[model samples]
Target: MVTVKMLKPYYIKADNDFIRVILAYQYFSVLIDEQVYQFVPTEAKEIRINRRTQKVENMGVRFAFQKGKDIAYLTMSELISLPDFLLQLDTIAQPYYFQEKTNQKNETAIIIRELEQLNLRRLIDKSLDERDADTFHSLTKML
Candidate 1:
């Protein structure tokens, strides 16, 4: 039987589309039949998770564990059965999602403010060209 002993990511990277969990050397350990094994990335590969579906991408990521003179790879099925690992990953990814939402809101607010200013400038220009002192004065007061 396989059981997860510890699964702590070194750092997490998040964007609008995906969240990546990066593991440092010897950071992730598991137990197979009461024997402990530390899984290491074959390359600088990270576990990619889709933000929308909250599932592992599992396309190009590879992890290997040394078993004496032989090396074995951790399979996708083993990863999927670990509910605690998934929960921890989600907890770490949640803050990034919140920050992304906050940033998007700030960007939207800035755009709205800029559009409002442009509209006001156009109105002021039109009022000045039409020789309407009352309209121009009202628009200038908005500044």
Candidate 2:
């Protein structure tokens, strides 16, 4: 048997957009402007890092889901918080991330580790709009 666990969802304001992120076992989903994008963590690829700005830029990472029918790209320009989020998700999605156990009745089980709640506000920068910042701040506090 396989079981899935998920962390609490958080809201992030990035590049003038509000995104709702839900992290789960093996996968993470994002709600962007009312559209939901679900992706497998292990499938995350096309990573590009910028050392000068210490950020991920120019479509640094791309996640494909639904048999490659859906895709989401993230680029951080001086938005420092995204790397951690991506790293955590990728780690858990790895094949070795899950453990197996056999019980007395010969039932096999798969267990997944719990993920920590992400501080979505950390992705926000001063360049964000004042109103959007206010909204994100309030939303973060409420969560």
Candidate 3:
């Protein structure tokens, strides 16, 4: 199962690709072109997968990378641009540069704080028609 999946490589080739898994959610799935793949992980003491899709053939496998280690993503177009010297890119190790900070951090915090509020006053104020109907009914009713 892929810890963190990328769609770039799979899109480059019509092979079986393992996408991602969520241990906390108890669910894992592989997708190609926005379609779920029915792939089964191989049991060879190594992280492997066999994908089965109609639009594509049943052939795509990605070995496991070291745990907690991340890889850099390269698009097919970018790969073509690399010189022959870069063909042997195995020596380079992709680092987790974003472990420090991400772009959406501040925006996410703002949304979470707004959602955590217990007050529904903002919602009620927005529906003026509903408020007017309730006020008129209360004034006319005896109790």
Candidate 4:
């Protein structure tokens, strides 16, 4: 069995509530109001701040996350609440940088190997089509 390592936990305030985020390799979990929501990296597509009400007395701020087919929103009554909410969102997005870098390297290696195989196959086909016994024998030996 293989053991999986977990990333450090981070906490931030959303209005009167404090949310905790736990990161892992391909996914992350968020705890809000004693409830935990597990989210996949790809599922979280957007994060933004929304303003509600134009009147100065009734203005409110809403921080939201667009996750796959659903949206999770949290509202704040004070403008000072924006910073912490933004910070938490930034923390949630951090692990994807390392994960994407590793994924890109693996994808590039796979593409290169596939291209090499295609070139070899083409060379073998050409040799057979021309009835070149010496070239065909050499190419087959390389395989």
Candidate 5:
């Protein structure tokens, strides 16, 4: 029996349409019976995923799996039976997606704070121009 294990990608890049997993240096592994086969990327091959559907797009992409001197290329049929693996990969890539959202939130917060400060400064200026000592003091204290 074949059991897939240690299926990791070196890097995951996500965009609006797709998530690409760049494979490198023993990033994927599978166990066939008792032997552990490590699949290493020999050329430029990436697992392209549809961002909305979360489905693997490059089903024909193959990786050469090696166990000591024994080596073989994984077949398309075998690659097709990997929905669970893709789900695991999605979990691994979740933090990267969340990180982008977090950065956007932080940027929005910074802009809002800057606008509030600017408004307060304008109020302070108006109080100075009108010679309103109480309003000027209150606005400056808000700074």
Candidate 6:
């Protein structure tokens, strides 16, 4: 029954390596009539947890981002483009650990290795070498 209505722009932060992001200031699947949840990124430092009154706009939601020393209102665009995500953002309360997709790098490695076996990497390398050779060669010439 989950539809685009449930997708909304919820703020999320990039992980340590900037590979993935955790949804910011939102919650989902509560039991009580007014139960809520807030999720904090395990790796978040400057803004581990934020509290604010987010401003809603046609584009999406906006809110103040506050940690101990950092304070600003950040906007998340894509998910806000969806509806469902917005519903939860308006509803959830209290902080919780944002459950994120696990085993990312290991799985990424497997996929990359599979592509390499199929020679896709070499093809990409050729394209890069051809297109970027002028730039690289220019640097060499300068050296």
RMSD (CA, Å), each prediction: 14.6, 19.6, 17.5, 17.9, 13.4, 16.4
Which scores greater on lDDT, model 4 or model 5?
5
Per-residue lDDT of candidate 1, residues 39-104 (tens digit):
767753577877766668875445676657666676665666677667766776666554666577
lDDT tens per residue, model 2, 1-143: 11112223332222222122333333444454556555455454333333223234444444543324665553332122444555543443322221231132134222211111233444343315454766677656644
The TM-scores, one per candidate, come to 0.57, 0.24, 0.20, 0.30, 0.57, 0.21
Give the TM-score comparing model 1 with the true structure, all chains together. 0.57
lDDT on C-alpha atoms for all candidate structures: 0.75, 0.37, 0.29, 0.45, 0.75, 0.39
Weakest ten-residue segment in model 4 by summed lDDT: 49-58
Instruction: List runs of model 2 lying over 4 Å from the truth.
Output: 1-26, 41-59, 65-68, 76-143
Q: Tell how far residue 80 is off in model 4, in angstroms.
A: 47
Q: After superposition, how far is residue 16 of candidate 3 from its true place, in Å?
A: 32
Model 6 weakest 10-residue run by lDDT = 28-37
The lDDT, on a scale of 0 to 1, for candidate 1 is 0.75
Candidate 3 vs candidate 5: the lDDT winner is 5
Give lDDT: candidate 2, residue 26. Answer: 35
Candidate number with the higher lDDT (2 or 5): 5
Model 3 ranges with Cα > 4 A deviation = 1-95, 103-107, 112-120, 132-143
Deviation (Å) of 38 in candidate 5:
0.8
Give the candidate order by descending TM-score. Answer: 1, 5, 4, 2, 6, 3
lDDT of 4 by residue, 33-127 (tens): 44444434333222322112111222353433333466555433432244553354445544433355457768999999999888888999999
Candidate 5, residue 129: lDDT: 95
Instruction: Kindly report which residue pairs in candidate 1 clash with one another.
Output: none
**Cα misplacement distance, residue 127 of candidate 6 (Å):** 13
Residue 25, model 2, lDDT: 32
